[model samples]
Target: MSRGFVKESDQEELPIIPPRAPLPAGVINYVTPTGLAALTAELNALEAEKADFPTDHEGEHRRAVAVIDGKLALLRPRISSARVVDPAAQPQEEVRFGARVTLRFGSSGREQTFQIVGVDEANVKEKKIAFTAPIAKAISGLWAGETADFRMGGKAEKLEVVKIRY
Candidate 1:
């Protein structure tokens, strides 16, 4: 059968799938207990949605299934490689993964709080930052009332750890 003989309507365009969140190479995929639970819930929801997809329109159904499968493919590895870290189990005296830290800036007398979490669970709106973030890395292992020099934009600013809680 020649391509010129085929109907144009028979050709199906592949669905575009979005990429997952970036995780740097060589870094372990660590997830808090809550983060792992959320991922599991998301996977289950996608599975249910795929299972309930309507089959009345064959092309639409196939495209929908393909998109869901793509998402599942990206998600499965994250879930499988996840190393769950319990926030409560961490040391309470110092900054570490899952620590909610309060920091004061030098000269400004201003304070801010952030929770150091896994890459999949980092949400700026919620004041949660990934453990790999520059600020998080700078402040890691510091005890309450300790200070660290944070460099940004070629300028160094002091960050004082006011409090640490798991």
Candidate 2:
């Protein structure tokens, strides 16, 4: 005797909802609004263009679309990403996630500053670097005044952690 329903013999169907998978540990996940828009655009583009490519010759296109999807799938995580690290933290001499590092470019006569961020907030032009980046990996857990070397344009460059801010 279902309330306000049909006969008792009529079976009611329950709503179907899929369970989501848990995020992996230590994998930081965060994305700025800009990043979210960019990923959404990529998704739209992929969906729109995927049908245009011939099924027999869409290997490269398919892979590219898959990559975009993979990136979008990281909007959440089990372990918070370094990009979302607390910005209000006090400045420290040690290099770590969310630290803004100033490095002296070896090849060029200039100094470059980068905010060590998670992959979601990484915008090289904006001087935001992902913690998982080569330079970040090399500098992470190192104290200020420590120098790390990396190759750029096939030439070696030395970078010094001059300053860090929350």
Candidate 3:
């Protein structure tokens, strides 16, 4: 309890926990059946990781646990608030949440396909986009062969719904 008694080396830096995807305020947290499973799996993995942490290195172990706990704190709310929607139950005629849609862009006339998924489940590599995304929103109520104007990079591009599948 004396001045300059504490050493700088004794201080530990707090781990920086990354935030999950942005779910806008007032928007419901919707997830596909598979998406909920994925979240559950993630929670299990984190729990396992925490339980298996080596104890010999006390400081490192503590930090790791803190990081895991921080991550869990962020994840639990998402899991609890999740409203699972069955893709198979959605209407096959129009684009909606959990629907795999194929779109044909104007001018280039090129085709691309993506699934409208939950915010937490959105992965570009998997061709999954969030329901709140602009393109997804634009095509939400559209049926096959219907066109919608989407603003991409401040320019409007026409998107035609070529196909929709749950």
RMSD of each: 1.9, 13.3, 1.5
Ranking by TM-score: 3, 1, 2
Q: By TM-score, how accurate is candidate 1?
A: 0.90
Ordered by lDDT, highest first, the candidates read 3, 1, 2
Count of backbone clashes for each model?
0, 3, 0
**Per-residue lDDT of 60-140 in model 3, one digit per residue for the tens?**
898899999999999999999999999999988989999999999996899999999999999999999999998889999
55-135: candidate 1 lDDT, tens digit per residue: 998888989999999999999999999999998999899899999999998968799999999888899999999998999
For all candidates in order, the CA lDDT equals: 0.93, 0.61, 0.94
What is the TM-score of candidate 2? 0.51
TM-score of 3: 0.95
**What is the lDDT for 56 in model 3?**
95
Q: Which is the better candidate, 1 or 2, if ranked by TM-score?
A: 1
Runs in model 2 deviating more than 4 A are 1-26, 30-84
Off by over 4 Å in 3: 1-4, 7-10
lDDT of 2 by residue, 17-109 (tens): 333233236655544444445545655665566556556645555555555455445433322332334544534767777777887765674
Clashing pairs in 3: none
- Ranking 1 against 3 by lDDT, winner: 3
Q: What TM-score, computed on C-alpha atoms, does each candidate reach? A: 0.90, 0.51, 0.95
C-alpha root-mean-square deviation, candidate 2: 13.3
The best candidate in terms of TM-score? 3
